[model samples]
Target: MDIPLPTIAVVGLGTMGTGIAEVLARAGREVIGIDISDAAARRAARALEASTARAVGRGRISAAERRAVLARFRTFSDLRAAADAGLVIEVVPESYETKLGVLRALDGIVAPSAVLATGTNALSVTRLAAESARPERVLGLHFFHPAPVMRLVEVVSSVLTSDRAVAAVTALARELGKEPVAVGDRPGFVADGLLFGYLNQAAAMYECGYASREDIDAAMRLGCGLPMGPLALLDLIGVDTARTVLDAMHAASHDRLHAPSPVLRQLVDAGLTGRKAGRGFYTYEAPGSAVPVPDALTPSPAAGAVPGRQVASVGVVGSGTMASGIAEVFAVAGYGVVLTARSPEKAAAARERIAASLARSVDRGRISAGARDATLARIVPAGSADALAEVDLAVEAVAEDLEVKRRLFATLDKVCRPGAVLATTTSSLPVVACARATSRPADVVGMHFFNPAPAMKLVEVVRTVLTCDEAHATVREVAATVRKHPVDCGDRAGFIVNALLFPYLNNAVKMVGEHYATPDDIDAAMKLGGGYPMGPFELLDVVGLDVSLAIERALHREFRDPGLAPAPLLEHLVAAGCLGRKTGRGFREYGRR
Candidate 1:
């Protein structure tokens, strides 16, 4: 059995409304597009004709189909024109009073059996339903920007919303070629709830001088595989709109993470709303331009170069995954590498791992067989710390334990040449703590790499207060030699990525604990609305709930900020041994081999 497509009435001819009307018309539905101003109605009609012509030009639709689609659309400036519509959707500004006014007006004009919907991202659908007489018929059909292109539509159902009403919209979404996820009526629903918190945190990081905007964005793009950085995404989604969503979510949950950063308010106040206004965190070429040029506020990349000693040969100490990856990175860059492990057996295991990794790279056409052989030839495996005697640099990538790392650095300080730059690949523990362990504190630096180091491009070059200009330059130069993007920062708790990332993940856990929305819905919201590569829970599962908790705890312990504390849900999950994919369970279940 199939449900009949309804004649749709879209009240409002703004960007969202016009896009929705175009979608409906293309789907062969009789679409009545309404606007209060005559000029706005005329403009929408012209826009539709132009858009359809472009579609024809792109060969997306035949000229006959374009004419047919245009004939299905009817533009009007009066509300009574929708009296016969089976469904009426209001797509006005995201303001409670404005939407409520539109809904009340639609309630009087549409038939008693007609379904009423709003395209709101953050407002309360339940409260909006109460304003109409037929509350059971009211729900939310939230389409993302450029509704015709984006495939997601959140079919939100309030407590008073009838299942029949929800089913109607869900079917309508499928008819119009959109994916619909059923969500409960709440502020920001699923997507904005998890998204704005992350964006707000990025703004705070920039305001605090934690890192430059470019570095902050690059960290996420290279580190997490996101399509765009948070700051740039914020610019795409206007600053004023982001603030409105954040204010609404904060009002509902009272979570500090949702509170808008002061810089956001200042930007909006300064008329730098975003791409729509021509200037934001980054200035645009013109209003509504997608391309962004460097603004006066862009921070310079890495302080002026320092005259440092050349790094020709490197030593990597450990038997762990990170250690092997680091050794491989250096060897492939034409640097002689000495990899040391505690025993002959462990050294053999590290060699095998690196060999298998290189073999895979060769099979994938990422490197030639000759290049792989040459890279492997550059690595020298040793079973003792004495092998690092003459290397220009030695990096300790052993473990996260402070005592273990400190012991290695002390040994390196004793064995390596005095001018050799000693670095630690610690992601959480302070670089200075490692520096204090070595005799040559001025030569100690931090080079933090994301997992699967050979593939991920980011390397946060951390410098302690005692680190000399020469040491910093050597590490930065090495990072560039390995074709990694280096961002310099002072010794800090989580560096840039973990400091900004973990808190956002922790907030998602709290949202789940509070029963605000289902995990799947939250994940879909973030992916569809924010264009993130993965949802917070999905990432938590992949990274391991236990590992995430440890990082969050370290962040809280160092900063003493209550907001950074690990969520109770995370603690319980870790304690219950639902570690993640390794344990076959975490926030979601996984199939084990």
Candidate 2:
């Protein structure tokens, strides 16, 4: 049975509180919105009105519905008005004294069964609950900032929180049209505990000048498919808030990973709190907007080979997944493509797969059937590299063996026209070695695409020392032609994305290795707390243990750093043939469904 929607009161009409109130009122709940003063309350009320009005403008809400929502909200100057409310969500400042005061006041006025919830993102829900007379009734309703827009809300329950309280609040969250994941009360709960640590470390890398801010941000946004770069997100979340949460998490976890970043504190001290102060990691046009202008001090783009532009015909060798994906990407970009396979049967199968994928795109309304047919028409399948003679660009997405790649490039050089750009989609092999395979080393570059190439947007255009300036520019142009974000980086073992991303993933594995948390807990913490689409363990399974281990091994070999060594656990999984979804087993058992 559905619990009746409670007469909800959201206390403290601050940024988070107002947003929460807006969500409740918009959801047809009878809401009481309160603040310390009338003026502050009015401003929050106005903000809510504007928010709903915009929803109406967007046709998300009818004008009549918006008016009804306004009528449902009641503003108050006194705290006692919330006494009869079945639930009071406290979204006050993140201070123990302040929260304790709110709870103690609510204890005296609220009915015996009324639930008291706090919107603390990282604070200990248990400690906060203990401040109330009825500890079991107190729990956390951790909502992301701009609560109405972000879909996730972590429903946190302390050890002392009552089962009924958790269940009721979880139901309430669903009523408000949000996805609620119940989590244990802990420092940082599920999301921020893992997320802030990663953000703090990324800041550390930026501070040390390991890479430029743009490159660092691009590495995640473009390289890893994150919604935003860490630095930019740090700014949006506010450096001050980040510092406070980092300090709280570090103090509680006692783990060095949760340490507060020094740069965060320094920026806070400089009054560059974040969007609130109009500055932080990156300058924002306003407190809550993302229109970013390049900071004059922003680092220059990393040095790399130039890409050539005159390519009219492209050759994609190999009919495996990557090669088929490459052919599709180029074909859709309107380039004449020669797709080769080891045998005619394999080439025919690859063409069928590509056509099926394109048909699916048409079904989803992303492309017209005619356009799909035209794109497929651009690809001419062949049985050997000999047909690549007239191609201006030859990209080998073949198997990863070094000798196999060397042999492919050597054959391409013999058959392809002079001045043809040679590229490799190898994620781990050194670009310099691939370049050495070609007589025109200056034309060979790395055009690394993530798996399921048609869907992923990043293309790491890696340049070797010998690669010409035109080669790098040409790669960037090709990336743009294929509608991908091109990030230029020098020849490094794992390049930018894997170099930074794998280490963090490995650290999470290390955390599990040390028995800090179960695999489910770790993954849940990241997805719920950090807002990542998938958890580290889930992503590990998708990427395959063998592939990840190979990249880790390459990084370790090149850097000779013990820290970069592949985890023994990962190697054991690979040895067991539990290589993620492909093998239906890995860190977690798959195929059970």
**Leading candidate by lDDT:** 1
Tell me which residue pairs clash in candidate 1. none
The Cα local distance difference test for each model comes to 0.88, 0.83
What is candidate 2's lDDT per residue for 63-126, written digit by digit as tens?
9999999999999978899977888899988887888899899999988788999988767888
- Candidate 1 worst ten-residue window by lDDT: 1-10
- Model 2 root-mean-square deviation: 4.7
Give the Cα RMSD of candidate 1. 2.1
